[model samples]
Target: MEFRHLGRSGLLVSEISYGNWITHGSQVEEDAALACVRAALDVGITTFDTADVYAGTKAEAVLGRALKGERRAGLEIFTKVYWPTGPGRNDRGLSRKHILESIDGSLSRLGTDYVDLYQAHRFDHSTPLEETMVAFADVVRAGKAHYIGVSEWTADQLREGHALATELRIPFVSSQPQYSMLWRVIEDEVVPTSEELGISQIVWSPIAQGVLTGKYLPGQPPPDGSRATDENGGRFMQRLMSDEVLSRVQQLKPLAEQAGLTMAQLAVAWVLQNTNVASAIVGATRPEQVLDNAKASGVKLDADLLKAIDEILEPVAERDPARTYETSPKERP
Candidate 1:
């Protein structure tokens, strides 16, 4: 697997990393989860991403169980905070109280003394950004977290946070965002800003929550055991399986065929095309899925093939002109 520098930090992560978003605790059993982790390691994936809110905090526990004993030292584990772990109001956000308490809980659950990287799951509009940054800095100083990051943060927020980290003498190494073939919003603002700020962009949902994998076709019934079949799968996504998106996916099938790769592999390769992207965090339920996603690391898309993909996706871009427009036009222009 190809390794890239995670922003300006000395750290380097594999091009394709493994994550437990909706699969570790909610969907797959322990044995299956262990097998998937093993597959990722076998393919040279050193980073594993998890979040405290995923599966109501059970995902971390499952990951801890999987990485128990000698195997834990061989991996770089990353997890996030800022989501409610319980019904209580104190259980969520990046408040100093929550941030202070949450990292300890995550440490205990993950069966590790420290995480390689700790991220804020989202911008905490309620708390002062300084408060949150100081709390994260404390963790780093205390040896509970090695590096700090934020997820789904706006350009302004990221800039402010970076300034705060510098003032506090804390190093913020990365940012995680939902980026995929179907969602290119980050390219307009987040990508460029991250590149400028020397923050690594470790993207999640690189497959558009499985939309680009060609699993849900237009007019077809939802596949058995798919994420769409879950109770939390809202009506919006259920209705999103439109003829247009599926047709676009169908058009791209031959491109994958010519490359001697699966559509899923092509989808992943497409996400990693951006040089600014440090890593793409892929979620997998089975060992084979891990193996399949890892294959994308080996399949390089040339400039011509990337142009072809852009052409194929142009129709979808036209449909959502607002999203296609950059929110930060000043940065773009």
Candidate 2:
């Protein structure tokens, strides 16, 4: 696998990182999850991303077991905070109490003393930004995490957070955004802001949650056992399952053939075409999927094919920078 520096930091991560979002503890059986993780490592993937909120925090434990014997120094493990991981008032958000308690729980579940990157899963509207940043600073100072990052945060949020992180002398180095050929929301603003702030984007859903793989047919029922058929894990994918989006995605199959790649590889490589993307995070339930996605590393697509893809997906792609995220009112702490 090809490697790149995560943002401007000295730390390097595999360009195609393995992420267990929906499949680790909820979507698939433990044996399948372990096999997939083994496949990723066999293919030279050294970066793994998970979240405490994923599968009600069971994903981290599953991942911890999968990586139990691996050398810690050779892997870049990333996890996130925020989102309700428990039922109590202090169970979520980026509040100082939540951050402190959450990190310890995450480390315990992940079976690691420290994570390479600890991220805010979302901008905490309820907590003061200073409180969150200071908590993150404490996390770093305590050696629980090497760097800080935020996921799906707006450009404005990133700028303010980075300023505070700088003031606190924290190594804030990455942004985990939902970027793909079909989701261009980050391109208009977040990419530029991240570039300026030395924050590289480790994009999730590079295949538009598998829509770009051409597996879902237009106006047809979703295949059995696919993400769209999952109750707990497919909520975010519902938006892109429309006939219009599926039809547009189907048009890219020929382009994948033209590029000498499978539809999934083509989709993954398409996201890496952007210079600001440090890595594309992919989740898999099968070992074959892991093997297919890892090949996306170092596969360069010509400008002409990229233009053709844009033309095909233009009508259906979500490009508005305003679509970054839903600003839910701060949950009562």
Candidate 3:
């Protein structure tokens, strides 16, 4: 697997990282999850991303069990905070109290002393930015986190956070956002800003939540056991199942066929086309899925193929324009 710097931080991560999101604790059994993790490791995927809120906080525990003993030391683990873990108000957000408490819980669940990257799952509007930054700085100083990052933050928020981290001498190494052929919102501002600030962009849902995998057809029923079947699957994903998007995805199949690659591989390679992207965090339910995704790491997309893909998914605008910017210290660049 090719390695890239996690922003300007000196830490190198695999271009295609493994992530436990909707599949680990909820969709797949423990043994299946363990098999997937092992398969990822065998293929040189060293970076693993998870969130405290995924699968009701059980995802980290499953990962910890899977990576117990010496296996834990061989990988760079990343997890996020800010989503509500319980009914109590104190169970969420980037407040000093919440961040301190959440990190301890994450460490205990992951069976690790420090996370390679600790990200804010989303901007917390209720808390002060300075308070959150100071708390993150304290965690870095205490060695509970190796680097800090944020997910789905806007350009202005990233700039402010970078400024604060610069003034405080804390390193903000990466930013996580939803980016793919089906969703190109970050290209307008987030991508350019991160490139300028020397922050690596780790993208999630690079396949548009499996819409680009060619499994979902324009007029057919949702595939069995897909994320679209989940109760929380929102309108954005519903739109992804539309005839227009499926037609666009179909247009790319010929390209993948010509390249001797799977549709999923083409989708992933398309995401890694940008040099600013450090890694694309992909989730898998089976060992073969992990292996399939690993193929994308080595599949280089030629200029002609890229132009074809852009033409197929043209009129390229932000998928979710309703998501506006919110300021917070947990936000990163």
Candidate 4:
């Protein structure tokens, strides 16, 4: 697999990292999840990303069990905070109490003392920025985390957090956002700001919630058991599941054939083409899906093919810079 540095840090992560967001403990059984993890390892993917809120905290435990035998030094495991993991008032947000306690819970559940990178899943409007950054710095000083990152943050938020991290002398190395051919919200602002500040993007949903896979056909009830039918992830796919979007996505089949890539591979490869993207996170319910996505890690698309992809998908793509602001929770959950 091809590897790239995470932002400006010396740490290198696989270009195609494995992540378990919707399919780990909730959608797939333990055995299936374990097999997918094994498939990722067999194909040379060494990075895994998860969030504390995913599947009610079961995702982290499942991933922890799946990686039990591997040498810890060889893998880069990442997790995030800033979501409601319990019913208590203080169980959520980036407050110092939460981050400090949350890190320990994550470490114990993951069967590791420290995560390679710990991220804020979303910006906590309720918490003071300085308070949050200081908590993160403490986590690093305590050896509970090696680096810090934020997800779905706007350019201004990134700039604000980056400055505080610099002041604290901590490694704020990565940004996690949803990026794909169909979702271009991060392009106009976040990309430029992150590039300027030396923060690389570890993008999720590179296939636009499976819309770019070309499986959800236009004018047809989605094929059985597809993401459209999934209760857990279906709500997030609503923005991309329109007939117009599906029709446009269908037009890319020929381009996929011409480029000699599966639609999914083409989608994943498209995100890696952006120089500021350090990695693209892929999640799978089956082992073969992992094998197929790993191949996209090192594939390079030519300029003409890229232009063709843009032409076909541009009409349906969401490029508004304001969309990034809409992604974050307005209030801490």
For each candidate, how many residue pairs have backbone atoms clashing (under 3 Å)? 0, 0, 0, 0
Predictions in order: lDDT: 0.83, 0.93, 0.85, 0.94
Residue-by-residue lDDT tens digits, candidate 3, 1-333: 989999888899999999998887888899999999999988999999998998999999999888787465668999999988877868888899989999999999999999989998887778888888889999899999989999988888788888888888888989998888988777878888999998989999888888889988877888877778876543448767778778778878888999889998988998898888999999888899889989899678899888888878885335443243522344321
Give the per-residue lDDT digits (tens) of candidate 2, residues 20-133.
998999999999999999999999999999999999999999999999999999999999999899899889899999999999999999999999999999888889999999
lDDT of 1 by residue, 256-327 (tens): 888788888888888788888889999888899989999888567888888888899777632232342332
Badly placed stretches (over 4 Å) of model 4 are: none
Candidate 2, position 311, lDDT: 96
User: Which one wins on TM-score?
Assistant: 4
RMSD of each: 4.1, 1.2, 2.8, 0.7
Evaluated at residue 182, the lDDT of candidate 2 is 82
Top candidate (lDDT):
4
Which structure is stronger by TM-score: 2 or 4? 4
Candidate 1, position 323, lDDT: 43
lDDT rank order: 4, 2, 3, 1
Worst 10 contiguous positions by lDDT, candidate 2? 324-333
Instruction: By TM-score, rank the candidates, best first.
Output: 4, 2, 3, 1
TM-score of each: 0.93, 0.98, 0.94, 0.99
| lDDT accuracy of residue 273 in candidate 4 | 97
